[model samples]
Target: MVDFGTAEVTLEMVQASQIGMKALGAALAVGMTGIASAIAEQSIGSAAVGATAENRDVFGLALLLTVIPETIVIFGLVVALLILF
Candidate 1:
């Protein structure tokens, strides 16, 4: 029954909204990183497979290169955690 024009925003409401925004940011950080990692891995995996086929000795180097892109996801998770906490 409160009048819309007379309604006032409280500090708690502002804080709650801030928390929600932070959560959204965290989710975005993780989601984008995961997507990027997948894209990077797709290309790297194909290249690695081709290289490995050319030289069996290159398997170790190819594996290392393929795994390097995974660090993006790990960093994203860390950023998300920081945003949430």
Candidate 2:
């Protein structure tokens, strides 16, 4: 047993801690997904640009592929919302 102070823990304190944890979870969900989306888009976008430069006819497909990674961010936002509320 360690007795160094007389700090009292209350219900409000516990509730606040839980809220903080939920916020942290939500932030991590969104942050990590955004980072992953950026990384994915970086490579896909470069490839799409190269493909588009090679042949203008491929522009539509390349654009579609490049935009696909953005859905991950939307998914992340949903997860974050779920975590937060």
Candidate 3:
């Protein structure tokens, strides 16, 4: 019976709607963050590995790109914490 933002649909009447929605939201939050970080780090790792495989002069750029995914992870974590807490 709870009203979520603007939706007036009743979960109590919908059986598994409430739980499903909660799980969905949690999944979306974490999944999106995880995906973004994975994609970012995947590229960075590939580039760094490729550079290492080729030569040792690309260390700085590799390190920099490797840490770039951290910002997205932090943002996702903060959002998840706010949602859970």
Task: Pick the TM-score winner.
Answer: 2
TM-score of model 2 (CA atoms): 0.94
Structure candidate 3, residue pairs in collision: none
lDDT of 1 by residue, 4-85 (tens): 8967899999999999999999999999999999999999999999999999999999999999999999999999999999
Q: Candidate order by lDDT, highest to lowest?
A: 1, 2, 3
Q: What would you estimate as the lDDT of candidate 2?
A: 0.94
Q: Count the backbone clashes (under 3 Å) in each candidate.
A: 0, 0, 0
Candidate 1 backbone clash number: 0
Model 3 segments more than 4 A misplaced: 1-23
C-alpha TM-scores of all predictions? 0.85, 0.94, 0.61
In the range 17-85, model 2's lDDT, one tens digit per residue, is 999999999999989999999999999999999999999999999989999999998999999999888
What's the lDDT of the predicted structure labeled candidate 3?
A: 0.79
Off by over 4 Å in 2: 1-4
Q: How many backbone overlaps does candidate 3 show?
A: 0
With candidate 3 superimposed using the best TM-score fit, by how many Å does residue 22's alpha carbon deviate from the native?
4.9
TM-score of candidate 3 on Cα atoms, chains taken together: 0.61
lDDT of 3 by residue, 1-85 (tens): 8656876657675767756776677667878998989988998899798997788888888888888897887887777666655
